[model samples]
Target: MNPRDTEEMTATMKRELLCVLLLCGAVFTLPGQEIHRRFRRGARSSRVTCRDEKTQMIYRQHESWLRPMLRSNRVEYCWCNSGRSQCHSVPVKNARATCYKDLGVTYRGTWSTAESGAECINWNSSLLARKSYNGRRPDASKLGLGNHNYCRNPDKDSKPWCYVFKAGKYVPEFCSTPVCSQEKNGDCYFGKGLAYRGTHSLTVSGTSCLQWNSMVLIGKINTAWKTNAQTLGLGKHNYCRNPDGDAKPWCHVLKDRKLTWEYCDIPQCSTCGLRQYKRPQFRIKGGLFSDITSHPWQAAIFVQNRRSPGERFLCGGILISSCWVLSAAHCFLERYPPHHLKVVLGRTYRVEPGVEEQKFEVEKYIVHKEFDEDTYNNDIALLQLKSDSPQCVQETGSVRTVCLPEADLQLPDWTECGAFWLRQARGVYNAPSLSFLTASPFYSERLKEAHVRLYPSNRCTSQYLLNKTVTSNMLCAGDTRSGGNQANLHDACQVNMSVSPYSEPTPG
Candidate 1:
């Protein structure tokens, strides 16, 4: 019975001991510390308990002297003797008092004979305030010193209190300043807890918190935001928490409240109520022909196929009048006939031949009298159509008319007016390709026309007819770089003439 029973009991005891250790470990671990000591519970508290016998004794003495003598008689004394020969005062059983026998002689005892010791401070203003001494609560209602008789026996000197005896002060009851995250726990401490009190907190620019007797409301947590282009206002947004974000109600005893948001970075106008100026759009109907007619239809028309023979030769023509076609005088200088100078009616492009082919009998080729063979001026010439075909007079898609300046009519002859003969002398006779043609009565369809540009004689290689041959009446219109180099060169795009002979009848 002895050996077997002893072995079993020993093993069982070891198992039980291990279980107890595990349970205790789980229940008692020091928080925020690496050490875990079961012996710590019995250690001394850093602060003495207020209810302890020694503390009670000290408090009782303070209260006794403060009441019977200080409050009722406004005077008290102590019996302790201090140096500088010696100092003495009457002893009060409850209080550890102090007395100044002379200027520099102070004695610590139970009571003092002095009327009101210099060491003891007093507060007599309507709004009483004071600081703590010996870490004790002053009898605020007693009216001995700084105490605002509001809260019954309020822990007066317990806080670093501030009092305003006068009405005005630059400093408010609570002041505030922003704090950075690097601060102690992101905390902006104030006067009472440290040495004085003011408002401060832990909030970021994009974030917010509360402070200042809970009077200050801060952050954009409850506001709303709208994108720059948003059609509606704050309430219309589904997700806008606030102008900034939803960071509201971060209420605190001393927080300054604010609402902020990341404003939409709108580079363009979002709302239209604000005044703005924009160019008026000219809305016309019809096509390029209509555009040209809306203004003076006189364009520096390009007459292609000047030398071709047969009835299909003249690729295009410019309307010199209802009866005449202004063309390259050299086109007829060769003594060409109706077949050899076939005029393409309403020719817009050379590659795509005109839909209607007009067999015109060159009635008479009247070249400008001064036309020179070398530099061809009076390069201007009128090809009077045969009087036989009356159909030529009618306005058809193939044949049309462009007004001409009267014999004595004068114009500034600007290149933009299609008077670009000046530019033709120069190597760079570049014109913008017309794509958007204004609507009007002349053009049937939206046709893309060639832009005509006139470079000055300064850019010309030949000087013979630099300014003479390419006269003011003679204008040049067409894409200088014809092939496909023109940017807006669509097959049917047209440049509608804006200023028309109908509008300006005669040049000013």
Candidate 2:
């Protein structure tokens, strides 16, 4: 009995020893820190003082040799546990740091006290950096600022420094300075808490700034554009570069010398005084007609006696169909009347000064049923020409019939949508002899303007529709996501509009 039991015990002992040796090798040779390194190193070899002023800490000085305990190039965590008299290491030039009192130190990833019996930490540096142990990207969490990029490096090329933050799995959102001296080509921007194309002046409040290039605007200010002095408004107070701790705020100077303050203080108000142009409210010089004649479906409506027709204003019409004659609706308003109405069939507004004008006569000028006498909703009317002149498709080069749509269609909702309008260059149609350049149609905004009122279905619905059925009959267009002005002079030719039917049209 004694021999058998001794042999069995000996065999078991050998197996246990082998198991211990294998386990030790596996723990020491892995990719991460060896088990021996789990305890703290009495002191680190070097120090790295955070240099950037924007860094959160108060000039934190850290151990450089802490790199080995940390996965090099990876983030490592460390903690401050309110140890009043912990010792720290200070680095000397070209030499590893020696321990000193009142500074913190960790040995093999664990915190220790110079005196005996300090509690081990749960949130020691290593544990803090390794909270979500799935080996994923660190969560650079922030409060108030929903998700944004937390940048490790800054870009040199961009103005108004920005931080790159990880928005989501590989996405990033940058938080940049909004006060820009000039707009950058593709950079996104926000001002007064509104986003817009980095290049355009932001005039709308709470309006998200958009992206777009800039162009010098040349034209007399329409009376409508005149600033209201009493309503002058203030912008933001931007910090000046001067060290006196002063801030300069921009305020919009309104017409008539009055001021309004919303976000900041109004600095100055001076009249531009540019209200003296004598040309018609809207007119074409002569060049926009070339392409107009090329479109088989296009029709031109000319208004006669735009200013002072006898007893009433007269307007000419182009028979788009038996159901429609394209004429200016303004021609038949109560303020203008239609007693002097006339329809000029073949047209030549320009002639050798003395030659008689070309044309046709109107039996009646039927203005649009919903046309507003004051606002001119549908700027068109039908002139029943004397004895329906033949639908001359040939004389009218491109005589394609324009189809109409129902007015109640629903449009999508948006913070804002752009509108564009186009007018051809002068002489582009009839007399190629003159400049054929036509200016763009006035970029008129709906609802947001001082004149246009929002429709109930359009504004009062459960949601707002930008191109709803009400806009079906109206030519509607918009800006690209870039936020550029769709009505700028260069893009003016691309503007298009449609006629929309409204159930409750504005009363005439």
Candidate 3:
């Protein structure tokens, strides 16, 4: 053997050993580096693969018991021995089972019960056993009972199962009252998920989850129900029962600013309907004398005639308020002084005065600010009477004020209305015009009345009035009589003259 060969082989062997050591070190270091990188990416590996044999056995038993009762894909389990414990989950396996026990089979504390012969507790039958033992109620505090420790059954179609702690142990009962299921999850659950079965509607006035068997056709999600329920003093959420008995439950909801039941029919509010007023008996026909106190608002206006020395009959007015009279603004065209005019009320005849007649001096007069003489628009005026008392006139059977119509009030076309005037020949409203007579031959000095029908605004426009400007504020009316012995034609002009104290006949 040569010494050089032996030395070379020895060096080779040492180098090979050093290379092997380096490879082993690299293998351990690389794995640690890779694990650190995986950790940075939120990946983790389990250090322990095998669980305690006793724990595995308990978990398998619990899984078998709990798989059937789960309403959803997940099921939660908890340790009965731990006082302050959390729920844990397991994969569901048996889809056919209907009953589930939430707490695993164990005693309620960490103390061993092997010598005492205390068997593992079964949540379903444990309550019944406790109730029967000693014939006394089970104290919840001593048993460490909580809402999480419950047994649920999901198979029964309707009125399934609800277990309530009563008479010391949980007994079959209805989940009528809300109970906390999980304090950390803020989930207060009703039992059997059928609290509102067969009911049309449910009101959750308090914050809690109400489980039911039927599907919700209409649900106010989040805060929508709170915002709209019983709004405007209306009743609670309205619902209709499923007539077919197969469809989901539905209810009324407010959509597009309107309330609709089941997204279809509209629901009527309690305040819907038209207001009505009492109808009077007296009527306006062709030319006739009005009953003595029939039109109590009538007033006769008088003015001092410029050509004559004393005051003479001018026009008529309607008393609207105690101190206010409504008339046509055109009546004041002559601009008579307020002191020179007088108003007489409760008078049926122009010359012959009534026993209940009252008189007043004009204090102030106001023509409409927007009066248009060319179109006769806004021809209304108000007159204030001079009086020592706040109320200018006392109301009586022959001196009542007329009610003003509301601003939005509408009347049908062709509605009949009355016109009133004064005639000297006839002492009352009855005064017929001579047939074939022209130029108002029926004129009289005493109060007279006639009827006319209202004309539509379109007919009163320039197209019908020989191009006369008619405005939206103006009203039109015409006589509707025909045939032999027809009544004289009544007009708005005649009505205006009868209701205005300052009106004078226009010169032809």
Candidate 2 lDDT by residue in tens digits, 1-508: 6998999999999999989988886776663464335533784423324432223343234211111123333332322222211122222211111111111111011112112122212221332333331111222211101012111112222221112112222222222222222223313221221222122232324222111111111132211223321011111221111111123222222334433212222111111111121222232331222222222222233344556753211322333442234545554555433434443332223221112223444455565677644433455555554443222222222233333324454544322322212221010111011111123242211101001111222332212332323233333232323333323322222222234232322212
How accurate locally, in lDDT, is each candidate? 0.30, 0.28, 0.45
lDDT of 3 by residue, 63-97 (tens): 22222234777654443321222245554444222
Error of 3 at 340 (Å): 0.4
**Model 2: what TM-score?**
0.25
User: How much does each candidate deviate from the true structure in C-alpha RMSD?
Assistant: 35.4, 26.3, 25.6
Top model number, TM-score: 3
Best candidate according to lDDT: 3
The clash count of every prediction, one per candidate, is 54, 67, 13
**Model 3 ranges with Cα > 4 A deviation:** 1-286, 420-443, 481-508
Provide the lDDT at 436 for model 2: 14
- Once fitted onto the true fold, the runs of candidate 2 whose alpha carbons sit more than 4 angstroms away are 1-289, 296-318, 334-339, 345-358, 373-380, 388-400, 403-475, 478-508
Between prediction 1 and prediction 3, which has the larger TM-score? Answer: 3
